[model samples]
Every structure is written in structure tokens, then in C-alpha cells.
Target: MKEAENRACEVMLHAGLLPQLATMETIAAAAGPVLEPFVQYLLRHISTPRGVDGVSPFELNAALANALIEGEEALTGLVSLAVSIVPLAPAAATTNSSSLTAATSGGVCSVSSLTRVRLTLHPAYPLNLIATDSFLNLHTMLWTLSLQLQWVAQSLIAARVCLWKESQSQKRSGTDNNTTFSTTTAPSTRAVQQEMLHLVHAVRQHMLTHVENTSVRMRRGIATCGSLREMQKQCGEYEEELRHGCLLHDTSSSQLGSRKWHNHNDGPAASASGSPELHSSLLEVLESSLRHCILLGHARQAKILINKAKQAQLEAEDAEQEALALDSLEFAKQKFSQITCAVAATEREFEGHRVAFMERVSVYGSEAGAHSDAARALLAAVDIQGRWQPQKGT
Candidate 1:
């Protein structure tokens, strides 16, 4: 077992995936105490120098940097998948008390425990020997992935909490009738909504930070283009017009200033006219940025809906508990109206973003057919909002 573990560590080190291996160790630690030894072994392996004799430190570091980048891409894909599937799972399940208890308690403990471990163990990769720009990019990706994982973990926790509460409610009610189940489920729904609101707020903050970092990197890339060679390197191609303009300048100093000024004026235009791969990549980044913004908006809307639903549930419960003069039917009508208003408001907000998202895709779609198709597919996968129905007795 020790030999196998060492061999695995050796492969990870040679592939420049020590950081990723560390991350996996952190994730695996969630499975329980059984994996503690494995995690410790990984920690020791990475910290100890097991040199690849022929490879220079610079080369190894470069490979590690590339691995960081690739891992980021993989994490982004996972986040996209998680977001797409978030609403597909039923928020609450109706089952026998025994089955529900077994499912919720057992499942929640294992999944949430593991995910929580990952959330806690995400480390700040050391930057002592790394280039500033590369480190910044690497850190941004790491932060984004960490946040995405946190969101997924929190979502799972919320589901688990809701399920556990439902199981408890089922046991308390001790009846299989629909009316009893619905009545008992109301409080749990409110509880779940509360947890979801907190999770969504955290996710929105992280997403905003991610978007800011990405924008800063994009701006930096555009601002640093200073010559034909630099422009070609950055933008991936130079037009004949730009090449001729470069030749027209008299002195090296003037040419340098001219190139900077010209690039500043025409950076977007140059990117538009650059190689297809370069243009597509830029568009993909923009699309991803916009998608994150849309996600933030969606999260905010979800919180609002949950708040409204909770408020309605509370009002209904209060009306029942108090033998007030106010008619229950009238109170129910008022609460339902408030929920409808909230839903309408959410729909309006989502529609605005949907329009903006579609406009972006349409503008870029003509330029990059394949990317636009993929973007459209992603857009299709996003749920505007689930259909709202008033719970019985509310």
C-alpha cells in the first residue's frame, strides 16, 4: 500500500499536479477518518523534495502553472454542470418516515461532511517563487473554483437540511394523508428557503469577485500591447494595414508611441480582426463573464422568491395559530397576492438579463458560429424560474 501510494505521488509530481493532488487530498478527507492517512501521506510527499534530476525548477514550475490553468478549465466545466442541474432535483421528497430518515440523515452526513472538509481545506497556493502575472491568474482561477465548489457544497447542505427536517416532520405527524403532509411541510420549506438565501448571497459575492478578476486580466492583456510583434503575440494576428502603419513611423521612439496609441484606439477592432481562435477565445471569456453576472442575478431573484414564500407561509401559520377576527380565506388571498407580486418582479428581472444575454450571443454569434452555438445551448439549459404554486391550506 505504501509503495502504491508513493508511485501515485510520483506520477502527480512529474505531471506538475502536486497542487491538484493536494486539492484532491483535501476533498478525499471528507470521506471520513479512513482517508486521514492518505491525506497525511500526500502532505508529506508534496513537502518533501523528490527531484526529477534532469528537469530544471523553471521548467517544472512552468508545467505546474499549466496544470493550474487546465485544472481551472476543468473546474469551470464542473461549475457549469452543477448550475445546470441545481434545479432538477426535487426540493422536498414525500416518503415513509423510516426511509426518509435513512436517506436524509445518512446521505446528508456523508455528503455535507465531505464537502465541508473541502471548503475548509482549500489552501492558498504559495507564490514565493512564481511570476506575479502567472500567480495572479492562477490565484484567480483557484479562487473561482473554490467559490464554485463552496456553492455546490452549500446547495447540497441546504437540500440535506430540508430533507432531514421533512423526515422529522413526517415522523411527528405520523400520518400518510396529503393534507397532513402539506401542513407539516410548510415550516420545513421556510427553513430550507432561509438556508438557500444565505448560500445564494455567499455565491453572488464570490461570483462578483471572480468577474472583477477576469476583467482586470482582460484589460491588462489589452493595455500591454506595444508593438507589431506584441500585437501579433497578444491578438494572434496583424492585418496588412497595421503592418504598413508600423512601417510608416520614422524613429523607434515615435514608432513605439505610435504603436501604443494605435493599439489603444483599436484594441477591440484588432481583436475582432484577429485569428479565429483568438477571437473565439475572447468571446468565450466575455460570454463566461456575462453568464456569471446572469447567475448572480438569478441567485438574487431566487432569494427574493424564497423570502416571499417564507413570509407567506409565516402569515398563514400566524393566521391559524391566532383566533383573530381576520378571515383565514382573506389572509390567504393577501398572502398569495404578495407571492404573485414577488414572482412577477423576479420574472421581470430575469427577463432583462435574458434579453441582454441573447443580444450578446446574437452579436457574437455571427462572428463565431461554433462558440455561439455552444453559448445558445448553455442559455437553453438555464431555468428562468420554476413554476410557483400555492401550497394547500396556505
Candidate 2:
């Protein structure tokens, strides 16, 4: 905007149009055609960093950074957990005398290894445009963004023209009424001019700030731009991502060793004590009770036999609980795979918007300013009607 404004000022000065003769109509007509390119430049500087239409994955997916950090911690926890727990099998004691597993209160634990490992991505939200990365979807978004920004720029240009018109109106009326838009109505003219200038600066600054922020995954330390507060947030999230970063990753991973093949275990009810061998166990208890009941008529030892069976049942339950923990890990692995694809698709769409933005910024920046000298000259000849503004040399 500054660049274009400077160039337009130069064109008017060089044309030698009588300054007093330059009416609002003449100025508008002179600048109209030349200002179109500047409008585009300003819009790109304003809207590109916000997202193609203000929905950016980088902005949307801050949870991915936390997920990444805690995820490593969770993984570290899992490893420590496995090492601490997985060796209570009675077979482990017999198989390796050198094993250092803690003694189980239950005679044995059925879970004997790290049966699974799973990952989970964070902040799983449901979305409407699930297939947002498709080329059709991406391009349509860019088209919408272009139209929105263009409308804003056009409205601003129209406002500048109206301000100029109102300035001319004041000169004609010679009313010290101190009006703004018309001879009768009023607003702060200086405020309007100052705001317009500040607005252009804001557009350029907004674009640059976000451009740096979006690179959180790539840059490090002071290279990534953000406020002091954001830098603090970046410390943990940023460090973990860099530590885990592998640039060339293969997305076609078939599995994560999350489940044991053909090892389907029965439910807790059956595993703990619901077997039809239940009949034999019950029969044994009944016989022992009968034999002791007679002695209880004379005080027999039936309670001791029943207590032994109860102890065995408690051990089976402990084993069942450990197996469920391993199963939970496997489920986590499944969730990770599903969410990874979704995240990738989103990031790809974000890249598309950025690329579209950069292509435009590059093209506009290639030229120093709008080429409007010819247009201004034509309008001057028509409006000023041969009244030559005196040249410095003349």
C-alpha cells in the first residue's frame, strides 16, 4: 500500500496538472485504473496468513503439539510399566531362576509380556468437511477467500474516493460549519485519514506474523516468530517435535505390533470361574461338606476346604485384570492409525492455501508499484482541459 501510494503521488506531481484545478472527479478518474493492482497486493497482505478463508490447520491444531509432548511421556510410561509388571508368570520363575520379578500374591499372573503398544492423537473433534483436502475443496476455498478480500478492498477504495469528494464539497461551500460528508452532516476527517493509513500497516503486519507462527514444526529457538508468551508454549511442544521429527516418513505402515495373532482369550467370567468343570468343583465341595456335616453334628473341617477353593478363585481374577490392560493398549494403537490420516489430510489443505498465498505475494512484489502513469495522464488531459500546472523549471 505504501509503495503504491508513493508511486501515485509521483505520477500526479509529474503530470503538471494545475493543483487548484484537480477536482475530486479528476483525481478519481486518474487513480482508478492504476489502483487495481495495489488493491490486490493489500488484500494478499491482509488475508493470506489468516488462512485461505480464515480456517488454518496450523491455528486449528495446537492440540497436536500437546498430544506430541504428552504422547512421548505416555510412551515412556508404557515402557516403564511393561518392565515393571510383565514377569509374574509362574512359568517365568521356573524358566529363568535369574529373573527378578516380584512375588505374586496370586500363585501366577497369566499376562507374561508386553502384548501390545498403541498410540493416540489428541483433541479428536468431529468435522463437517472431513474430505477438505481434495483439490476441488481446496480451490473452491481459495476462490471464496479471493472474493471476500476483493470486496473489502473495493469498499475501502470507494471510501477514499468519497472522502476526497467531501473535501472538495467543503472548498465549494465555504461554510465554516466543519462538516464531514456533506455541508450539513459531520464526522472527524482527520480521524478517517489516520485510520486508513494505520489499516494498511495492520494488514502487512498481520500477514507476516502468522507466516512465522505457522512454521512451528520446522524452525527452532529465535527463528520462529511469536510473542514472548507463545515462545514459552513453543518450548516444550517445539522441543519434543524436533526430537521426534523424521523428515522422510513412510505412511504405509501396515501395523504396530499391537495384537497377538490367534490368541483370543475368554471373558473374565469364564476365565475366573464359570467353566463347566464347575460341576466337578461344586461336587467336590458338596461331598466334603456332607462328610464334615456329620462331624459338625460333631464339628468337622468343611470350612477349611471351602476356603482353599476361594483362594484359587481370587488368583484367577488378578490374572484377568492384567490381560485387560494389554488389550487396552491394543485399542489405543488402532485409534492412532485412524487419526493420523485425518491430521495429514488437514495439514495438506493448509499447505495448499499457503502456496496459493505465496504465489500471489511473489507476483505482486515483483513490481515496485502499480503502472498508472498513462492512465493518470489521460484523465488529466480530459479533466484539467489544457490548464497546465506550472512546472518547476517553467
Clashing pairs in 1: none
Candidate 1 segments whose C-alpha is farther than 4 A from its true place: 1-128, 131-142, 145-333, 368-394
Backbone clash count for every predicted candidate, in the order shown: 0, 3
Cα-based lDDT at residue 39, candidate 1: 30
Winning candidate number (TM-score) = 1
TM-score of 2: 0.20
Please give, for residues 339-390, the per-residue lDDT of candidate 2 as tens digits.
3233233233323322222222222223232212221222232222343321
lDDT of 1 at 313: 56
Regions of model 2 farther than 4 Å from truth? 1-150, 173-204, 212-394
Q: List model 1 lDDT by residue over 1-394, tens digit each.
A: 6566455434433443333323332232222233333333222222212211222334433433344344433421111111000111233222322363332122221111121121112223221111133323233223323333343344445444644565576678663333122444445444433433433343334333333433344334434433323322432221121111111111221112112211111232221233222222222222222222223233334434444444555666555543432344344445444443443443343334333333333333344433333333322332224221211110
lDDT of 2 at 132: 22
Name the weakest run of 10 consecutive residues (lDDT summed) in model 1: 79-88
Candidate maximizing lDDT: 1
Model 2 lDDT, full chain set: 0.27
Model 1 residue 387 CA deviation in Å: 21
